[model samples]
Target: MPHQQTIERKTARTTTKFTGEVTCKGGSSRGIVKDLSAAGICFQLYFDINATTGQEVSIKSDEFGHLTGVVQWYRGDKIGIRLNVSSNTSAQISSYYKYFR
Candidate 1:
């Protein structure tokens, strides 16, 4: 028998253009999502929302609706967030990447 190798997909991401409203404890801002993945999201804020690492926030977008996540990192006004999602939401993210962008 031939040896079989296992393949793994850690996280799948897609580059997209969508406007989302981000709400955090500090404030809310209109952000443009640069990309989205099953594991995380990245966006650039137009206004200063004053978000920091580990801060929980929710984003409302027309394509994906509302998604909640914790801030993972940042560079200037752009931020990376690790998503807190159910299995359904994970599947939705994958589908969006597959079919849409």
Candidate 2:
């Protein structure tokens, strides 16, 4: 039997920039998505969209569709959100990564 190489799964991904929104404890704010994967999404906000780690929110994009996620990380105005609805459209999103790189 031949051994198959283990493909490491990565949630850190880049895709075509899209207009999106994130709703959390602070409130909903408009932002631009830098990238996305089955696990999470990284976004950039022009202004501070107040939020914190583990905060649940809604993320919507015309091209990628809607998703539920939690705030995974943030630095300054850039943030990463871990997706709860990772299965709905993972394959579709994974393909988008090629354009971003």
Candidate 3:
């Protein structure tokens, strides 16, 4: 097999273990926000659900309001999502970290 390299296309903010929840058309899953950025976010669900790539989702928590995004990737119970909103999402998350951390 040829060696493969994965390139990161987005500038990810510093990782933070923030708790949150994700909801889809089928149901909802609780998870921890592992990494966050202006373009996307990465989180790990406490329990695996029937989630797949290209699926639309909504994430919400006490620190931030409902965020709309689409699932970009998933492995086991961890998932990466690309937000549909503007870059303001990143600023809000960054501010939350600075004040709450």
Best by TM-score: 3
Q: TM-score of predicted model 1?
A: 0.81
- How far out, in Å, is residue 52 in model 2? 0.3
Taking the tens digit of each residue's C-alpha lDDT, what string does model 1 give over 25-46?
Answer: 9999998999888888899999
* Each model's lDDT: 0.85, 0.75, 0.82
How displaced is residue 51 in candidate 1, in Å? 0.4
| Order of models, best lDDT first | 1, 3, 2
lDDT of 3 by residue, 1-101 (tens): 99999997757565878899998876789999887877788989987767789999999977766788999998998999888867667677667767876
| Residue 57 alpha-carbon offset, candidate 1, angstroms | 0.5
| Candidates 1 and 3, the one with greater TM-score | 3
How many backbone clashes are present in model 3? 0
Better of 2 and 3 by TM-score: 3
- State TM-scores per candidate: 0.81, 0.73, 0.82
State the RMSD for candidate 1: 7.0
